[model samples]
Target: MADTEFVIEPGRQDLVMIRMFDAPPDVVFRAITDPELIPRWWGPHVLTTRVDRMEVRPGGRWRYVNVDAHGREWAFSGVYHAVVPPERYVRTWEFEGAPEEVALETVTLTEVDGRTRYVAQSVHPSVEARDAIVRADGPRGGRESMDRLAVLLGTVADM
Candidate 1:
């Protein structure tokens, strides 16, 4: 299993995550941007994710909701700022529960020895906001999500 490395510096408003995938960059990129594949690996294994809306293009908007076994829901929405296929994408992410605390996120995919190196950086409005997310078990959720994605990529690459 690939481990997700998180970089959280003191007093910093940004969080960086790095992970390696066994699939090629294009395969990894498609798994992330394709709405059909998103639900398969978007969040924690216990939660079922639904992509309400997703338009993978510049200026497009996207939204997804994750429902737990107890019927609880967590909704997240974002707008794409830049969309470069098989390479990188920039977007703004906001969780509905925390209305105005938005984070500008950049996801980059690089080819490393025929595999993909995934790097994501999320910049929050303030250091406090970033810290709040960390306190909310964000890193654990992220790690789980990436782990799920890695599994999906293995199946996807086989196809």
Candidate 2:
């Protein structure tokens, strides 16, 4: 598995994450957009994820909740702005705990030598907002999620 790289530039309100998967774009895309498969690899290993709502089309809404061992839940919700299967999608992301700090996120998957290169760009409302996420170890969570996704892709690559 390739490392999940995060690009955070100074004075910028956006962050970009890149990772490579040993699977085709279609397979990778399916693994990401399929609600049934999401809970399998959507968050940290210690948390159980549940897809409360997922409508994978333009103007559709999606929500996911992660529950810890102690039964504490963290929810995230978003609305899809654009959707192109196996290629890209743009959406808004907001943690229910801090709804005011919504961010616009664009995810793109590119084919590279038969593998998939996944890139996600998240634009926050301000530099402070972006910095806050960094301070909160958002990248670490993202890395863990991607690591899980990679493992899932390996299992479902032939499906």
Candidate 3:
């Protein structure tokens, strides 16, 4: 149970998130791509997440919604561009609330000494759109999600 730390770097038109997990690359990859496991760690603790549709393959479409305690839902949808099992994945992300804003995201996982380093790079349409995501607490939520993912991986390991 080491401290789960994530580095978030924001650029003019992109954001990069780096995190280390005490697990293998395959485990980390499954936690992210598996619809069953996604709800366990995809969002902050205060919200409940559900993956309505998940097809992890090229040209596949996916959608998930997060519901707050008050039952308000925040939905997100995306299209998969590439899926490299246990290593890399590329997709487009869009929040239903902000239909015009979209980001192309690439997630790469590397393993070293039984630990995996997870990196997610997101390129937005513009700097303003990128900054807006950060200002909206995207980093905070991402960090929380990683923390939860770490815990979930630990629990899964024991099972």
Candidate 4:
């Protein structure tokens, strides 16, 4: 498997566009959907996460708690908008720390040859919300999460 890599771009939607990973689409999908596999790869590489509840179907809700270095525990909850096996999924997300800032996410996976290209889109309600997240270096945390995912996959994707 190749390591997960991503590029973040600022846009009208306050989008975080990324081209990541060189793993099988199923593997990447598993990283997103499997409760047992999630916390191991979920969150900024520096933060630790624990899945409180995860149900991966439309209307199913998922909850998680992330603890930062300062021992601050942040709680996040969301409902799954859609889930279709190992190909794609969409969900609505919000953190307790920022209730006004909701994030709608769409994740797509594709496999070429022996590798999978993973893309995730996060749409915020406002440009200000988007800018706030990016300026906070959101993807750095995501990068760490992906690195954890790579580790859980048993190996990093090809860097």
Highest lDDT scorer: 2
- Alpha-carbon deviation at 120 in model 1, angstroms: 0.7
Clash count for each candidate, listed in order shown: 0, 0, 0, 7
lDDT of 2 by residue, 1-159 (tens): 389999999999999999999999999999999999999998888899999999999999999999999999999999999999989999999989999999999999999999999999999999999999999989988999999999999988684
**TM-score of candidate 4 versus the correct structure, residues matched by position:** 0.86
Ranking by TM-score: 2, 1, 3, 4
Model 1 stretches astray by more than 4 angstroms:
none
lDDT of 4 by residue, 1-159 (tens): 344455445556646545555577877787778888777788877678899999999999999999888998989899999998788999988877899899998888787785666678888898788778778777777677766765666563421
Of 2 and 3, which scores higher on lDDT?
2
Report the Cα lDDT for candidate 1: 0.94
> Which clashing pairs does model 2 show?
none
Stretches of model 4 off by over 4 angstroms after superposition: 1-11, 155-159
- What TM-score does structure 2 among the candidates reach? 0.98
The TM-score values for the models, in the order shown, are 0.97, 0.98, 0.93, 0.86
Clashing pairs in 1: none
The TM-score between candidate 1 and the true structure equals 0.97
Instruction: Judging by TM-score, tell me the better candidate of 2 and 3.
Output: 2
Per-residue lDDT of model 3, residues 82-154, tens digit only: 9998999999999899989989999999997899988899898988898898889998888899889989988
Model with the higher lDDT, candidate 1 or 3: 1
| lDDT preference between candidates 1 and 4, better one | 1
